[model samples]
Target: MYQHEPPTEESPKEYKIKHARIYILLLIGQVLFPNKSGNTIHSKWTQFVVDLEDCGKLSWGFTVLANLYREMCKSVDIKVTEMSGCVLLLQAWAFTRMPIISLVAPLQAPYPYARRWCIKKLDYQNNPRHHLQGYRFRIDHMLQDQFIWRPYLGLAPQRHEDSLIWSSTTYIICFHIVEMHQADRVKLQFGHLQGIPEEPQCLVEHHKMTTIKARQKAYTTLYSDEQNCWLHRELFMLDGD
Candidate 1:
């Protein structure tokens, strides 16, 4: 059995600008090219829309997966025989039973199977296209968790205990194991970058379309190149007048 702290006040209201682009892109893609091309892979735009609509189910699934992960990590202290059982169960959960999807899919707002894309503005000056900084990717991922989906789920804010203890213990242990087996350990070099001061940019301040109809109108008018440029802007640099 898994236990979690009681849900407190509602989470923060957050917006995902990049996802709006994806929604608009899929909308355009469907209108322009409804039929499949020469490639064997078929587009999942319809299913993606359907998945987005299943927000409740997605949220529940996320809760279950979080508990399961917590329980698996807790099993480290059990007897040897029970530990063997835990190992098998962890393997099934982490591998055979579609671990990535089970863990990450619930975090998504509405889409289940959509290919994950990093929508952050890439830094070309410090880290070029060929050699990308791993930390940048990790930061982008962390922001996605903090800003994008977590808020959408309306999860309560984490308590001090949850933040300082349970959350850290469960995730670090479970994910560290996963990375140890599956990931290529890359030592990052952040020598001089540490001294550089942080610059905050307001990228999500786009024209607010409150209503669904208004949003749909805005999406129809939004050009792909414009969206790309807006998404890829340097976070640390302010746009010139």
Candidate 2:
């Protein structure tokens, strides 16, 4: 909390505080509004502060982040629970010739297990662009030296055209991990990804098509197969719990 406003009414601080408070209240309104209909949180926050009369460029960054922090605080429900531990699931996509979807699942031990897979090519093509690629999902956990990217099956699969693999794989892996670890709660977080392509529709079309059923089947099959393989591998590692 940067306090630039003076406590005295005679000071310019009085005017600044009044105006700033008005904008802050509107921001709070947006955050608290159920079914937000306006611009995104970041957009509204930045615009509100920048649009304020006489507000300068230098303080904009700080104010935006700070107000966002305030809103997060307001929204978070501080609850007491019996479970003592929690895990965070971070998902991010990297755009390239063939995009990569990265997932890091939390284990009971001090470190986490990561997985990265390439998205399927939705459009049929004679000359396939890429086969397989290696992507390192780096996490700056605690110390700079303590980063782990293991179960390192580099991005490979490139067949199905629906392009639902990324979201499907994410759900499958997350469900398996949570069930295995029996985590109290999972904090789903997204990374700042850019230039990612839009999600593709179901591959089969024309005859009585339902996206839900097709995606459900794909997710289930993938999860079962992957889970079995993952568990078998884990059993061999003496370090795993």
Candidate 3:
């Protein structure tokens, strides 16, 4: 049983931007300290801030595995890379069953399993080949609930919430999924990245596409609800730039 609080009239349209700032910090950490390839083998602090909002946690496991499965499907167009991100995800799902997908309120625009992460521009002059070329090879993950959507930044690439529907309207953190359960833990185990769990389940290769599609459809319903409200209210951001 989940409980979501819809946006109130008083809620401003800047929350999405705030969420984007948090996401940027987390994504940076993932790239800098990816599994086995980076400086530190593991860091709890690094993990916590990744999702800040908690699905912001084991939900990533879901994302990794779901992504892996999604890529294999013929209908899915995007692709997740072959690296520790996927490996870590398998580890997490094996033990937790909590895919990052389950962390946000069911209202998020479901991540396109086939497509790569969304983005806007790049500072390639200072960045590496991966980001400059549209590759987010790293990610920071957390097991908390500290994020909400803000809709100030237009549908630029970096604004990774549910852009298709949000358009450039208000960006409020529409969903918050903090409570825990079996699925959450499973996603972590699936990733085989569990810190204490010593063993692996190796079940990442066996999920049904229906589960993946179900999650996506669910996300759509939730996102649509907000998008419709945005259209009616006409509460889009009004930047001076």
Candidate 4:
């Protein structure tokens, strides 16, 4: 129940709190983890907003990243016409890690590192396909040293608790979608010496369960194995030097 007028000092405290929660929910759905239909938000996220106190403890960044990975994987199908998830995150990752292909100069911004690219003004390409081809060519020719594997080293907040799980090899659970966060596969990104990672986990069943028909099903029922894997993520973590 949102008010047309902005909450004033006279407004009830509960009403103000509810309004703030609503705003946050909208932001999460629209900007953070938007689906193919940009205008509508899935009802699954409403549970998180019901108790704002628990929000901080949640691995939201990991969830967003996992969703993006899942969406990208789905988009590989030639018949797939629409792509979902945060494309901005993808761009920011590319810009930070592959600076040679980045069109704009990096801004010296604080935490929430994606902001560094937000305020930039870039020249629009008349033909996007040609521009994409150029990016592909540049990426193909990129040297090993040219890639900034440890781009956010010393920039991430050391005190933040979430940083502990930055390199945790586990499944990132988002509702019915359970995607693997194979941190061991990208050990160099975490400033660790690359080693032969263990065999990848088979998640074919999880992928099959994340279809449109399965969206309404309970996440716990579908992803109990994934939840167990996440709980024991320390075992999966790479023992890199």
Candidate 5:
């Protein structure tokens, strides 16, 4: 009933450049350009986003979500559902650790169950809003939050109910949370991270390597898994149909 197929080739950089560029030009730039004037619904993707944003119905997205909201609305005791929706899965753990909504099979609620919270580790490590802190390239993107370090964009797995399924869309619109505030890609490369400003004026940098054991050991304590997780234990992302 199930099967696996190894990839014939993988060139993520090429794919992302093409895919991301086209999307910006067509969907966002065409429709929401600051100065450009388009009176009609030139792009279907824009229309869908508006419809979803306004209609608040299940007519827009192909997203996976936690069950907390639905359960709360129904007054049913249930856990949240994490990691649902989209087809392109971004396991940033292996890549640049960019907090993009890489797709995966829509995480769904199982049958005959009230709730279960399963997705955990992946959620905690990817801190949300770290793009502001400027660490899409840093393996450890923990940021100082008041007195604690939080995952740049917390990516904890969510809990869910016993009934959910995946439906197709003409296209899925995923909002990438990472964009360069600093232009000149060369300046933003991994090498320049050393010059990043520090808050308490004590943070230092170590030369990275294929295996930066000493560096990691030093930085590991910078974050707290218990206190400043990126994902909320009680409220998971409740993406809808």
Candidate 6:
């Protein structure tokens, strides 16, 4: 996935290592945390790959979720031409929770529930708008009983154990990107009683800090403050008990 031409012969050890890092970054950009730029990997991710071994220790799932939330929010702007981030997550979420609109039946899989809809070569391009309107109509008229509020209930016990923190109300931080995980607002997803959630935390300044110019000027400060927010994230939860 590196931009450079392939070497004619076996590469040097250093060259091989560098190529591997580039490949990993490509996977991150194209799959995990894709942006609107398509295949163009951002330089900001270089620091994470510098110590390749430590990359596994990072909270990559949270980063993906944070970026996806940020991109979805940004898509509200009428001027925005393209949406980005791991949109596949959104699709998988919809398929799992809104089964009436799901094209394929979910498989009885263990964890990584997204794999259930791994049907290849499904033609969604045939009358795309018709499908879109159908989905919209279903969602718009969906009754509470038709929605699978707790779709994972029948999954293996181990899956539930592994996802204990899925309902955490906290700030998901990934460098300049920080988005609130307002789990309290969506308690039904976790089989909890729903209550009127308070107004969301004001993150306007933090959002502004993510701008290119602002990131250049205060990248360290922004990341530090985000990290601090994450560290004390329990305090941000709506429920005290």
Model 2 is weakest, by summed lDDT over 10 consecutive residues, at 182-191
Q: How many backbone overlaps does candidate 4 show?
A: 0
User: In order, what lDDT does every prediction score?
Assistant: 0.29, 0.31, 0.35, 0.76, 0.28, 0.74
lDDT per residue as tens, model 1, 1-241: 1133333345322224335435544443332222233222224333434434453233222223433443444465555222211222343332222222222322333322222222233223432233346434644554322322211124335422222121111111111111011001110111112233334222232222233434455443544444343234233122111
Better of 3 and 6 by TM-score: 6
lDDT of 4 by residue, 103-146 (tens): 55335766567775556655334213347787888789889898
Model 2 / residue 101 / CA error / Å: 9.4
In candidate 4, residue 177 scores what lDDT?
75
Q: Once model 6 is optimally superposed onto the true structure by TM-score, how far is the C-alpha of residue 130 displaced, in angstroms?
A: 5.6
Q: What residue pairs are clashing in model 1?
A: 51-110, 52-110
**lDDT at position 107, candidate 2:** 25
**Tens digit per residue, CA lDDT, model 3, 1-241:** 1133434557565654345545544453453225435443334334455454563433343233333443333233356443443434433232222233322222233343212222334223422333423222212343434221232243456754433322322322112111111222222312223243234333332333244354565545544553464445334422221
Least accurate stretch of 10 residues (summed lDDT) in model 4? 121-130
Measured with C-alpha atoms, the lDDT of residue 34 in candidate 6 is: 85
Q: What is the lDDT of candidate 4?
A: 0.76
C-alpha TM-score for every candidate? 0.18, 0.18, 0.19, 0.84, 0.16, 0.78
lDDT of 2 by residue, 1-241 (tens): 3355434656586576665765564544343321233443423334445445544433332223323333333354466222111111112212211122222222222212212222233332322234232233322122423322222233233422222211122211221121122111111111112233345322222112233444555535644654573445323222111
Q: C-alpha displacement of 133 in model 1, angstroms? A: 34
Write the candidate numbers in order of decreasing lDDT: 4, 6, 3, 2, 1, 5
Which segments of candidate 6 are over 4 A away from where they belong? 2-22, 106-112, 120-130, 216-220, 223-226, 234-241
Query: Per-residue error at 98 for model 1, in Å?
Result: 26
Q: Which stretches of candidate 4 lie over 4 Å from their true place?
A: 1-3, 8-11, 120-130, 159-164, 197-202, 211-217
The alpha-carbon lDDT assigned to residue 187 of candidate 4 equals 90
* RMSD per model, one decimal: 23.8, 21.3, 21.2, 3.3, 23.5, 4.3
